[model samples]
Target chain A: MMRRIQSKALLASFSLAAVAGSVIAAAIIYAPEIKPVERPLPTSFDPGEVAKGAQLASIGDCIVCHTADGGRPFAGARALPTPFGTLYSDNITPDEKTGIGNWSFAAFRRAMVNGVARDGSHLYPALPYEHFTHVDDADLRAIYAFLMTRQPVEQVQPKNDLLPGLGFRPLLAGWKLLFLHEGPSTRDPARSAEWNRGKYLVEGLGHCGGCHTPRNILGGEERSSDLSGGIAEGWIAPALDKSNPSADRWDEASLFDYLTTGIAGGHSAAGGPMGPVAEGLSTVNDADVQAIAVYIASRMKPESALQKAASTVATLPRDVASQDPASSKSTIAHPATDTLFAGACGGCHMPGAPMQVTGRPPLSAVSDLRMTNPRNAIQAVLQGVAPPSGRGPAMPGFADILTDQQIADLLGYARAHFTDASPWPDLTAEVSAIRKEDAR
Target chain B: MTVSLIVNGQRRTVSATPDTPLLYVLRDDLELNAAKYGCGLGQCGACTVHLDGKAVFSCLTPIGATQERQVTTLEGLGTQAQPGILQQAFIDEQAAQCGYCIAGMIMRAQSLLDRNPAPSDAEIRRHMQPNLCRCGTHHRIIRAIKRASAVLGSQNGKGDAS
Candidate 1:
């Protein structure tokens, strides 16, 4: 009877120990370090600084995610689609209840720099704190001030419903350990101030690397291959590094022109993700633009030199008949064609037409004709020319009147006359495919 | 609810639901078209404006909350006759396309320059990241802001009309 009593006592002790262990485990799993934040009073603020902060916020595109579609600005609820799961932006307005009304300057800075929320929760990387990490304290203060002064909305963002293992907040702590770095360090004294500035902007707030730089398999930015180019949401963000094959060929003036107006004489137009960047850059100061230009120019590699040399060496034949298959005995075949082009296409296409329709692209300026891809030029020729649908009717299509051979000849003539590039491949098959796709 | 406010230095009154966003009130009722209707939520800087001289996303601001506050729109920043230094810089830099987000861009930039007359490129970029321009002119936009900074830096605080 005494032995049985002793055994029961041992069992009770073991059960109590097990329960204690479980409680400790739960605490470790759930509890995180929460830092205290000092809140800013609305009255004690600098208006000018806040205003400047507002502008910086605009350039950073704070509103894009902070505001939902047709919802109040900074009220959050914008769902950002990512590989892991959908992340909803939190309300940033100065509302005491749902917004960040009570966050201190230091807390705001921590969130922007370390991706740590006030409650010690890990903010998803989609907030781009990795890039924001480089932002200066003054700017953060200003942003905080601006946010504080704004009207607070009572909208609460939805919780991020992530997959099982991904939902754990501790996982982000490990991810941050791998990828997150401290803010921008001191600039290299040897480098030009402009270059340093460009470097900071490109690597930091502009977060050009976020899009332009390719990512690793883990979805982390490939730091070694900076500005090499990447695909984001089906649009290709071109290589911004100096080694770009196209950059070496484009002069600084052309680059400046393109950045300023979203149109350079020839190379390419600002489309896809670049369009908004160009618009934002247009608002930047000339010195900064020059700094960017200086940086870009410095990055040009030898490949650009080769491209330029090749471009200079290849000249088009003046007479189409010299190479025409059907015009061996007929000089009129070439001259007649020249006359037809001069009358029909020369007025707009040769010099470049003004786009009258919305979203209608301008015609090939001499530089555009020189590009490696002749698809645009070929399409323009085959389709004759139509005004861009929404914009203007600067050019009209003549596909109904021109035969396929004539169209091909016109394309050949364009290549010879405007660019030194080789003739385009036979696109008859591709054209049919495009037509069918368009019909669908 | 009826809210009395000063917009671009002009006293005005707006009548709307208390919960109605100041963005809609400014764009729809007051017809101050500089602030845009980008994403209705505040993710885009397209709807940034100034409340009592501080930059705020107007879309998130409710009319009821802005009572007696001074509001400034891009139109208030400057006009064709006498454009703000930042506005002039934006035009000189050719900073707009689609012009859909220019007002917000200007407001944001103006706010930045107001705080730091000479911001570094990184600072400018960080400050401007919240503003989305689908056209990808960020490189130039940074330049334009720097240019405006230089312009503002050279002036001896003469343009603080507000």
Candidate 2:
């Protein structure tokens, strides 16, 4: 009789442990649904707060990913390609049927901080909550107000095309558990107030590290090597630091020019995904932009380079071309490449080209030409630098006309002429690889 | 500084800054009046010419880069008395307004015809996109290219689906 009693007790204990385990698993993977409120009246939000939210949203670059090409702003359908699969953006417009119109401030905050939706499902980390979590409640509130007042557009976002098994939202809970560090980043007291603000904005809304920092196997930014250089939208977001491969060091003024105008002469132009960021920052307040430059320039070098202002004009290559008695001294006896370069790129790139006279930086001064990896330069050749807005056309892409081998030869010739850096090894293979990647 | 280039199948050398744009070389030094100077920024194709048998903006190509390359201007295409097939087609179609962009339009069209003997309407438009005709004579230019293509295709006895 005593043995039977002990066995029954053991069974009861096992059942209890199983119940506890189930509850813990549920808590980790599940979030309680926030009650949806009625769409608030636009007038309910203060005008000043709305305007501030507008500025913050610009810095956040919400529209860049949120809006589909040729679609209404904030009426999301932008396809963001990931290693997992493609994920469409959510509509942030005030449409009650399709967007965040009924979302309470609490729901919005939860989504931004925890990558959770109003309906309690886990959102993909592609939303960049890792950075948004650094944003304070007050700023988030302002952004909420701004979004709440937007013109409603009744557009349903397309379903995410995640890999099989990965489509299950519950799996994201584990990812968040491992990577998400919810709360504000600590302010550095040793830094100036402007610098602190810059840090806050950059780490929070700018999310510079999302692109500038390397990612691990799970696609989480490697926090240990923040802003050291990473790939974004298939283009290299070069290290904004001493490790930056550009010929010239970035000063605050140059950084400001680059961040605001999308191009800083003698340094680099903001191309690919970075173009929109500059376009967005151009609308921001000058003082705030200046603070960002000050902080980023300091973060970039942390040395005397920051103190010295970079020259706004690019002149070195032009000077060299004027002084160069013989450009035929290229060590490579490549006549085909020489003719191709003369016809294709010589118009803008040759030393005496009018582009040089207009202060367009010569290829030699560009970091792409000097980088150990030639992908960026190859991309530049293939795609060209597209302008940020509808203002003007940019460098014409040559992918349609120039063959991969011809491009390789041209670049080989350019490297020999423009930079002392070692010629890009197996250039045709690299160009072909990049083309395939871009196509994918 | 002196630079040498083959112009219209003739080897020509001129004394100028090696960095001087080919547009200035062809115009100022060689006295070839075919390629014009419009937007020196390469946006406008007014200074289009064939370098090494490819259409390039002479305004942007430095003389130094043109060494050992065949530079052909509209003047090289044909004289006023006898015009090239493409030029004849343009004249027949009257594909010019102010005539500023005509020389560039001809050179650009010649490159297309050389590669794609018979091109579709879309292909012609896409190829001619880089060069701008401010006079709104694109339809005429398109017609001329098509006319030239048909003639060349018949002459070669090779048919292309266009």
Q: How well does each candidate superpose onto the true structure, as a TM-score?
A: 0.51, 0.74
Question: What lDDT would each prediction earn against the true structure?
Answer: 0.65, 0.82
Off by over 4 Å in 2: A1-21, A308-336, A389-393, B1-162
lDDT, candidate 1, B1-162, per-residue tens: 677989888889878765567788888898787789886545567988877766666765656557777888999878999998889888888988788888888888888888888887767877776688988777777778888887776676645322
Give the candidate number with the greatest DockQ.
2
What share of the reference contacts survives in each candidate?
Answer: 0.00, 0.05
What's the distance in Å from true for residue B85, model 2?
Answer: 21
TM-score of chain A of 1: 0.65
Q: Indicate the residue-level lDDT of A378 in model 1.
A: 45
Candidate 1 local lDDT, A139-232, one digit each (tens): 7888888888888799999988676678777667666767788767358688789878766655666676777788876667777887887755
With a 3 Å backbone cut-off (N, CA, C), the pairs that clash in candidate 2 are A347-B60
Sliding window of 10 residues with minimal summed lDDT for model 1 chain A: A385-394
Q: Residue-wise lDDT of candidate 2 within A266-325, one digit each (tens)?
A: 666666888899999888888888888877887876555544434533334333444342
True lDDT of residue A332, candidate 2:
47
User: Each candidate's chain B TM-score?
Assistant: 0.92, 0.96
lDDT of 2 at A222: 88
